[model samples]
Target: MPVPPLPNAFLIRPIAHRALHDGNRTRAENGRLAVEAAIARGYGIEIDVQPSADGDAMVFHDYDLGRVTTATGAIRQRSADALANVSYRTGEVGIPTLAQICDQIAGRVPLLIEIKDQDGMMGSDIGTLGSSVAKVLRDYEGPLAVMSFNPHAVAEMRDLLPDVPRGLTTSDFPKKDWLLLSDARRAELASLDKVEAVGASFISHKITALDHPPVLALKERGIPVLCWTVKSAAQEIKARKVAQNITFEGYLPA
Candidate 1:
């Protein structure tokens, strides 16, 4: 079956990166408070998911818990119940499950979810995290889409949630930043060779790499292009020359 069209709602609103986070000064990234803040302000919300030890999808970023939480270990090492009890260093809320986030949003606004790569190196070693996300969103009735930096993970979502729109989170794959990927792998990813095979409906490319040939080519073919982490109004202005929408943070898009 063909992937559903990328909804205009996703293109019309400035998506709040990790839900309008402010360096964790008040609302922590992916925290319940942040999500509520985004909804209150009328922006689409984008969040990442990582699987818990028990194969439940948890709405938190980072493979490790040390950065955002007082806890100190791999997030995948803990059970969903244990993760729900873990405290965030920046706020009072515990880690949220995907189900919890879905109920929180309740279709009030469009949701864009990025499935954080469990394969570590963007390989084919996936299934658990993707399946967990699929299970949680199976009955969700809302305007939403799923994507991943890992094409294999996106492919998994393609099979698991055939009715849901899917996309690729893409980048230039610079060697210095992507040390885990080999030269061949980086070239292949940069080329976006798997986009057609995986059936991506859109692409959220790295903001700085929006002009990359393959991304522009996809845009020429009428693909809706979204860019990530645009931190300021000026960057948003420049990114809009190529991107149809943005995933932004820091200052609010006007």
Candidate 2:
């Protein structure tokens, strides 16, 4: 099957990283408030999902609850209901399920869903996160896509939801930053050897590494290049030299 193209809505609008979250403010990342804020501003919403203990997809950025919530443990250790009731220290809102977030968006704007790497080593040992995300997105009607830093997860989505557009979250994979990944693994990922095999329609690469040779090579082939965490307008300008769109936070795009 041919790779599906990303919707123009996604390519045109600046995607808000973790929604329009303001860090432990009343509008927490991936919370309903953040989703609403992004919707109101007409920015594309970006969120991360991981499977709960019950195999339900939860919209959250961290594998652990320590950063955003009062609790401190692996998010997967909690059930869906338990997770839903755990409030953010600032927002007083519980974490939401993928289903709830989708229903909230209701096709308001483009949605980019990142499936957080469940495999600790970014290898083939993935959990049910992909399947869990697929179940919620199967019936969803919107301009949406799924991606992952782990190629294995993207491959899983290809088999489970062939019709939805998917991509890989690419990075330069600096050794000190990614100590969990061995040199061989980082080398393979940096080369982007899995793009075609995983059926990725686009790549959300690191903003700083937009100049990476493989990423530029993919763009030369007409593959869409999206970049992550562009914090300021200056970064956006630099990233746009190669990236077709951006996932941004900390500052609004003009």
TM per prediction: 0.98, 0.98
Q: Candidates' lDDT values, in order?
A: 0.92, 0.92
Give RMSD to native, each candidate. Answer: 0.9, 0.8
Residue lDDT tens for model 2, 1-254: 77888888989999999999887677788889999999999999999998888999999989899999988899999999999889798856588999999999999999999999888999888988888899889999989999999999999999999999999999999998899989999999999989999999999999999999999999999999999989999999999999999999988897
lDDT of 1 by residue, 74-97 (tens): 999999999988988886658999
Q: List the residue pairs that clash in candidate 1.
A: none
Query: What shift in Å separates residue 245 of candidate 1 from its native position after superposition?
Result: 0.2
Q: lDDT score, residue 132, model 1?
A: 84
